[model samples]
Target: MTKKNIILVVVAFLLLSVVASGCSKKDSTDAEVPAEQQVFEETAEDPDIAEEPVEIITGAPLEEPLAEPEVDEIEEEEPASEGSKAPEEQSTSLGDQPVPQEAPVQITELPVESQSAEPEKPSGPSIQLIKTNGETFYMSLDDMKDRSELHFSGSFYWLNSFGSTGHTDFKGVKLWTLLEAMEIVDSSSSRVKVIASDGYSMDFDISQIKRMDYIDETNQDVKLPIIIAWEENGEAYDPSEGAPFKLVVGQKEPGDINKPQWVSNIEKIIVE
Candidate 1:
């Protein structure tokens, strides 16, 4: 064989041995790595491969796992019967109570015999003349008309406290004539009290009751008798002018205020 052929053969065998040794070392390293470590490395390298989550156990393990509690089901109520009422429809509230009715009242009218009658009116105007001897005489206008000698008509001047002076005509019975007829004026009766219906009173002696003298408006001396006047100014006396009866008297002097001596609405005359 030639020298160049021998050298070529030797170089070929050395190259083949080096390749075989490298293959065997790679196979041994792959066999030494655990399958789990290999799979972890492969997973870390490959992004597409999803790694399963690992659970870390802490404290002590329980004997058993807890179970879910069971729930109770609610039952529905049945509808009420036609004859039986529901609890809400029962009449138990205060507004549902029945009201009591009241009875009607009856009225009765009074009979004619049970009613009161009206009182009768008086007959006419009358004066009560009382004497100290417990004797009462009721004198009226008719008594004055029956006796012509007792009635007198005259005009007399009068003066009042308010500077008023006037002369008025009057017609009535004389007080002396009436007293003489009734036997009231005597030596035993010294004073006479004249009272009015409005609680006014005047006192007169026996001499004044029989006669009174006055000075007229002409300053002339005039004499007159005290009279129980029933008419004035040709007209019957009205309530405003002391109706029924009034004791009239004239002024004694020119300035004598004798109007207070006149008793108006004379209701009573007492002789004592």
Candidate 2:
């Protein structure tokens, strides 16, 4: 063939081929797009793929909690019962504690001078007389005695007329009598505690004294000589036997020399 005729034939054949291929491509694209969209909708709406209902579990039972018990408010009690008196709240003091109360006391008269002797002082060394109120008086026995030489040397006697060693008379003034003679008074419940220089002490109740009882019981023999003596055996009291002054209680048994009680030192007489 000639070169121009061959070229026209090839160009026609290429254009027909391109037109057929475009038609086939358009049909294929439309079919594939519809199938893909349907598949996607089915995947989205499928019940099998949806989330299942969850089974929840709580450890405790599901029953509702019991309501809190109702609180009954307490009402004030009635003032008094039908025929009874109202209750009274009584106060009490502690049983163990003691309440102080006024106590009773016995009183005695002050020492008043019943009789006054001479103005002469004690012939011996001065001695101190201590009073209950703590006052001290410096005086000799003479200054404080109502009778002369009642407390002097050789004033005491162990009467040996019976010649029996145990049956002798001791002449002296009664202790209470001497106390009364000195204007020393005491109450009914009083006691005279005589202390010695060596710290020995003896207590004599006025009520128990034989002479005091003798005077009170019989109301007689006011002259019975029971004395606080200064001498023994015609000599001044030995310092060992409470020199200077000692108490000699009269014999309740007459002529009983063994009954001549000799006590000494005469430190103090506490009357209570």
- In terms of TM-score, the best-performing candidate is 1
How far residue 97's Cα lies from its native spot in candidate 2, in Å, is: 42
lDDT tens digits, residue span 1-272, model 1: 78999999999999999999999999999988876677678777877773564343534455786677877766777776876754443435666664444565877878978865432323567677777785777777677767888988888788888988788888998897899897766778888999999889999887788775645655575677889998877877774555478888876666788877888889889998
Q: What is the C-alpha lDDT of each candidate?
A: 0.78, 0.51
Backbone steric clashes in candidate 1, count: 0
Q: Show the colliding residue pairs in model 1.
A: none
How well does candidate 2 score on lDDT at residue 65?
82
CA error at residue 216 for candidate 1, angstroms: 2.4
Backbone clashes, each candidate:
0, 7
> What is the alpha-carbon lDDT of model 2 when measured against the actual structure?
0.51
